[model samples]
Target: MFNEAVTQGDDPGAAAAAHAHGILPSADFCEVVLEEPKADSHGDLSTNMAMQMAKTQRMAPRKIAEALIAHLDDKTGMIAQTEIAGPGFINFFIKPAAWHPVLTAIHDQDGDYGRCDLGKGMRIQIEFVSSNPTGPLHVGHGRGAAVGDSTANILKFCGYDVQKEYYINDSGRQIQTLGLSVYLRGRELIGKTVDFPETCYQGAYIRDLAAELLARDGQELFEKDEAAAIMPCARYAAEKITRGMRADLVDFGVTFDCWFSEQSLYDAGKVAADIRYFREKGLIYENDNALWFKTSDFGDEKDRVVVRQNGQTTYFASDITYHKDKFERGFQKVIDVWGADHHGYIPRMRAAVEACGYRREQFDVLLVQLVNLLRAGQPVAMSTRAGEFVTLADVVKEVGRDAARFIFLTRHYDSPLDFDLELAKQKTNDNPVYYVQYVHARIASIYRKAEANGMDLGGFSTDDLTALSTPEDVALIKALARYPEAVALAGAAMEPHRITYYLMTLAAAFHTYYNRHRVLCEDDLRLTRARLHLITAVQKVIRNGLALLGVSAPDAM
Candidate 1:
C-alpha cells in the first residue's frame, strides 16, 4: 500500500503530480521503506517517502508529503488514517482488519513462515571449524562450529544452495609434529631412553594415540628407522583424531557436506598447478629464492611467500589452491569461518581471490572470536598445547548441545563470548535457550488445556481474528510479522545472532501477552479461539526461528 501511494504520487495523470508541475518522475529512483512507529499514537507504520523524493522532485519535503498523502490510494480501506509527522514523515494507521492476513499467512506457511528467497538458490560454500586434527576440539572451536553451522542454516532458509564444509589441515609440519610426538611416546613405552623434545605435542590424547599404535603395530614399530616410523604414526594419528572430531561435531548437531583434506590438494597436484597458473598470470614471482604472491598489488600490506628458500610450500600456497578449487567447483560465493586471530589474513586472501579472477566480494571470511569458558563467574583454565583445555565434547556433555549452541550464537561471531556453564543449565529466564524454548512448551500446554476444556480443538476461521483487536494483540501480530524480515536481514548480513535476538524478543512478547490475557476464556469462546490461534502462530514462528539456529523447540521445559 505504501508502494502504491508512492506510485500514485508520482503519476503524471494524478492531480498531485499536476499540481506539482509533474516534477516527480518514476518511483524506481527511490526505495519506499516502512517502519513501525515506536509510539502507537503516532501510527501503525511510518515512512519517509516524501523526504526521499524531495530532492528528486525539486520540492520541499513537507509539500511532497502533503501531496503524497492527498493522492494515497487506500482503495481497500487498509489505512484507517494517514498523518504527516515532523520532517515530512508519513504515518499510516492501518485498520485492524489489515493485520488478519498476516495471521492467516502464518497459519498457511507454518514452518516456512520466516523463510525467504533472498539468495534465489545461489551456490554458496561455507567452510568453518577447520581445526587442525592435532588435538581434541576446544571451546574456541565450539564457538566457530556453532556460528558456521547456524549461518549455513540461515543461508539455506533464505533459498541459497549452501554446502557446509570442513577443511582438514591434515598435512605438513603440524602432522609431522603430531607423528613425532606419538613416535617418541611409543619409544618411551618400549623402555628406550629418548629425549622428548619440547616442540612435541604435550596432549594426553597424543599419549593415548601412542599406546594404541603400540598395540596395533606392536614393538616392530620401534625397530624401524625413526623417519620411516614417523610417517605411519602421522597417518594413523591424523585419521584417528579426524574421526573423533567428526563424531564430536555430529554430536553437536553440525554435519558437513564435505570433509575436505588439505593433503588432497597436494596429492592431486592442484597446489603446484595453482602456483603455475598464478605465475603465468604474473601474480607470482621469485624473490629471495622463494615464490611470492603479489598480494600487495591487490591491497595486501606486503607480498607473501608461497614457497620457502628450502623448497617447501607454505600453508598460504595450499590455501590459495583450496580457494581456487572452491570457485572451480561452481560456487558463486565462498565463506571461510576462521579464528579472530586470522583477521590480518583477510586482506591477503582477498588479494588471492582477486588474482584468481574472482571479485573480492565473492570471497567472505567470518572471524569468530575466542570463547572464555567459565563456571559460576570464575574462569576455567584451558591450555590447548598442554592438553589442559576443556574439550567441546565436555562442554556439550555438561550443558547439552542446545544450551551450548544457543550461548555461542547469543553474540556476534566477531565479539568474544563468555560461556557460563552454570548459567546455561538454569531453567530460569536467565538461560536464553530455556526462555525461548519455554514459549513453545507453554503454547503446547495451552492447546492441551483447550482440548481438556471441551472447546473445539479445530482451528478458528479468519472472522475470529477480528476479536484480536486489542493493542496487545496487534503488537503480538506485528512481532510475528517481523520474523521474515529478521531472517532476510540475517541472511543478507551473514549473521545468525540476529535470529537468536529475534527469538528472545518474540518470546518476551508472547510471555507478556499471555500474562495479560487468558487464551481459553470460559465466558467468551470467540475471543478464546482468536487468542488460541494467535498463540499457535507464535509457537510455529518460534519453532521456525529456533530451527535456523540448530536449536530445538521443546514441547515441555
Candidate 2:
C-alpha cells in the first residue's frame, strides 16, 4: 500500500536535481500528502513542495512551482490534472478512469479491500475498562470498552498483533468496602440492627452478591465476627462482581484476551521488584514516611507516593508494576484507554514509564471522555455506589448488541457523548446505525427479489462498470473507493470514530442511490447488472465495517 501511495506521488528525477542543488522540495520529502477527494479546494491531492523548497532554494514559491512542474510526469496514477494553486500548493485532479478500477478491486478483495499492513507487525496491547470490582460498569466504562475494543480490532486489521486486556482493580479499599457492604446487607437481611456506613458500596449487585453468599454459605460467614468475615466476604463479592462484569462486557460485544488483576502484581512480587528497581535507580525515595517516585523530574506536577504512610500501595504503584509487566511480556506498545476523569494520571504514568528506562512514547493513553446517557431527553445519573446505573448488558438488552456497540463508538473518545436511548432504539433513518445496516439489508433484499423472480443477479460479471453511471451510483462508488484510505487514517491516528463516520457517509450514499435508481430495470439489463454489482460491493464493504465495530449488518430490517 505504501509502495502504491509512493509510486503515485514520487518525483525521483526532480528529487535528484533538488538534492544536488540543496533545493529539496516537500514533494521529495513525503511520499503522499493525501487530499480528501471531497475537499478538492486542496486538490485531489495537494503538497506544498514548492513552498517547502523555497526555503532551501532561496527562491519564490512560483519559481519553485515552475521548477517542480518541469520535473512532474504522467506516472502519478489517476492524475488527470496537476497544477500549482495558492502559495506553491501542487493540486491534482484525478480522472474517473483512475477511480473506476477501485470498484473492481473492492469486488475482488471483498471485505478485505481496505485492510493494510501499516503496523509492520508490532505487538500492541490495549487495556481498558479497568473498572473496580465494586460495581457494574456504567456508561463511562462502556464507552471505554467500546473504544478500546474497536481500537484493538482496527490495529489488528492494520497488521498489528493486538491484545485486548481488561485490568481488574480487584484488590483495593473499594473491594473491601464491597465486602463490608455485603456483610452488612446480609446482617440486615438476617434482622440485625447494623448501620451501613456511607462508604460501603450501596449497589444492588452487592445485595445480590450477599444473597448468593447467604444461600450458599448458610450464614456461616456472617456468623463469624466482623474481622474474620470482612476479608472473606470481600473476596467473594469481588469475584462475583468480576464474573458479572465479564458477562456484561461479553454481551456488549467487547471481549478481553486478558483480565489482569491489580492483586496479581503484589502476589507475584512484581510490585516490590519494580519499587526496588526504582529505588536502586534513585527514582524512589522515602519522605514523610511514604515512598515516593521522583516524577517531578519527568514533568509530573509533583512526586507521587508509591506506598502511602499507611503501608498500602497507591494506584500509581500498581499501575507502574502493571505497565512494567506489560513491557516485560514483550508487547512493543502498551495502550491504555481511560476516562477523562483520569486525565491527570496520564503525565504520572508517562513519567513512571520513562523513569523505568523505557521511552514514554511506548505507552499510549487514550482518554475517553464521559458519556451522558439519556432515556428520553433527560440525563441519567449513573451512580456506581448506589448500583442504580445502567449496565452495558442492560443497554445491549434494550437496543441490541449491534446498536449498542455502534453508538458507543460513534464519536471521538476524547469527546463527551450523549447516548440517548430513544434515538438508538429508532428503526427509521433517524438512527445512524440502522441507516448503515439498512443499506446492507436493502441490497440483500434486492438480490432475494431477483432470485425469487429467477433472474440470476450473479450471472452477469463484466468489466464495464462504467454502465453504473448514475450520479447516485457514482457517488456510492466514489465513497467505496475511499475506504482503504479511511482505514489507514484511522489506524494511524488510533481513532476508531473515523470508521463510524465513514459508514454513515457510505450509508447515506447508498440510500440516495436506492431512492433514485432502480437496479432491476427490465429494458436496461446491462445497467441493471452493473448497478447490482455495485450494490453487492457496497453491501460487502458495509458488512465488513459493521463487523469491525462489532455491529450487525442484518439481511432484513
Candidate 3:
C-alpha cells in the first residue's frame, strides 16, 4: 500500500540533510522509492535511497544508510525494525499492527477499495473491434474487444471519464464486395447462372442474406440493374451484420457507448473539408495528380497518399478526418484498439494526430495480436476469406462468457495467445478463471458454514484483527493492499493483462492461506471472527478485480 514511505510524512531526504548539513543535495534531487521485497525474509519494504545519494555525499552507501536510519523519525511506530541489506539497501520491517489499517480500509471501501484518482476525470475515448461489417467477429476481434473493454474499465476505475466506441467501417470496397456477394448468390437462387468473383465475400452468411433478401422482396430484385442492385444488397447486409455484431459483443460483456459510422464523414463532407484545411496549411499537396499528406514532417518515414490520381480518396484520408473529428469532440485522449496487422499504421496515424495540432502522446493504439484457438492442444484452423473461421459467438457458446474473457486477457495484447477450448471449459485448477473464481466461492462457503454454526458475521472491528498475526495472515493482507497499486499501474500502462496477473497472484495467496489455516476455530471464537473478516476482504478484492476485466465472480461454483 505504501509505494514511497519517504514521500508520505516521513522525509528521509530531509532527515539525511539534517544529519549531515550541507553535505548532500536536497530531497528533490532524486525520488526515494520503496518497493515490497519479493521474499519476506528480506523485509516488508526496501529502498536504495542511500546508494542513490552516495555520489553526491562522497560516502559509502552503507554508512549513509546507517546515518539516515539513526536520524530517521518513526513517530507513528509503523516500522518495527530496519536492516541494511546487500549493496546498501535499507529494508524496513513493518510492525504487525501497521497492517491492520489495510484490512480495515478494505472493509471500509469494499467495492471501491482499488479505485484511484490517477486520471482525475480526464475524458478518454477507446475505440475497438471496429471490424468490417462483411462477416461475423472472429476470435481475433474478440481479443481486441476484451482488451479494449477492460482497458476502458480500468481507466474508468482510475477516475477517468471513459467512453467506449465502435467505429463502423460500413462504407468501402468491403461493403461493395459484400453487396456483390449477396447479389450474385441471389441471382443463383433465382435460376440465373452468375459467376461469383473471388474478390467478393465467400461466407455462408452471404448466401443466407441472399436467401433472406429474396424471401423479403421476392424475385423482383433480379429485375434491377447489377449496379443498382448492389447498393440495396450492401445496405441490407451491412445493417444486418452490424446488428449481429452488436448482439455478439453485448453477449460477450462488451457494450459501446457510441457507434460511429465511417460513411458519416463522407456524408458530412468532413473528409474533403479536412483535406482542404490541410492543403491551406501546406500539409497537403497535389503531386502527380494526387493529393499527398506530408507525414514525413511528423516522424513518418515518407509522405502518404490521401487522394489517388483517379480523384478518389484513400482510407488514410478518411482516417485523418475521423481522428480530427475525435479531437474536435473534446476527448483528452484517444485510444484505438487495432489488430496486429495494422501495426504499421500507427506511425501515419500518430503523424495525422500531430498534424491536427495535438501532441503525439494524446493518441495511443493498442495492437492486439492474434489468438490461436485450440482444442486439447491442437490448433484450429481459421480463414475469414474462405469462410472457415470459428466465430467469437461459437467460442462463447462453447466455453461461457466469463471463461472467454478471462482467457483472452491472460496474455498481453502484444503477445500471441493460444486459447485451449478443453482447458477453458474445465472446472479444475488448470482453468485460470475457475481457479480465481473458486477463491470467491470458497470464502462464500466459509460464511455459510459460519452461519450454520451460529457464529456472528457482523460487528467486525479493528480489534477483531488482533488475532491475525501469522506470517500467512500478513502475506494475504499484503496482497490485498497491492490491489490499488495494480489497478493504478494497469491504467497508467494501458495494459489490462496486468489486472489478470494481479488477480492470479492474489488468488494464489488466498488459496495458500486457506489451505494452511483453519478459519473456523471452535476453541477460539476471536480467531474465527478475525479470519472471516480477513477472507471477506479478500473476496471483495477478487470480485472488484474480476469486474474490471468484465468477468464474473460467482458465489458458488
Candidate 3 least-lDDT 10 residues? 1-10
lDDT of 1 by residue, 1-557 (tens): 43343443454345455356423444644676988888989999899978887776666777777767766767788988899999999999988878888889999999889888999999999999999989889889999999999999999999999999999999999999999999999998999998988789998888899999999879998767889999899999999999999999999999999999999999999999989988998889999899999999999999999999999999999999999999999999999999999999999999999989999999999999999889999999887657788999999999999999999999999998989999999999999999999999999998887788788646667788899998899889989999999999999999999999999999999999989998888788888888888998999999999999999989987
Error of 3 at 212 (Å): 0.3
User: Once superposed on the true structure, which residue ranges of model 2 sit more than 4 Å away at CA?
Assistant: 1-34, 37-93, 458-461
TM-score for model 2? 0.88
lDDT string for model 2 (176-221, tens) is 7777889999898777888888788777777788889999988788
Best by TM-score: 3
Worst 10 residues of 1 by lDDT: 2-11
lDDT of 3 by residue, 405-456 (tens): 9999999999999999999999999999999999999999988888898876
TM-scores for the candidates: 0.93, 0.88, 0.94
Q: How would you order the candidates by TM-score, starting with the best?
A: 3, 1, 2
Q: By lDDT, highest first, what's the ranking?
A: 3, 1, 2
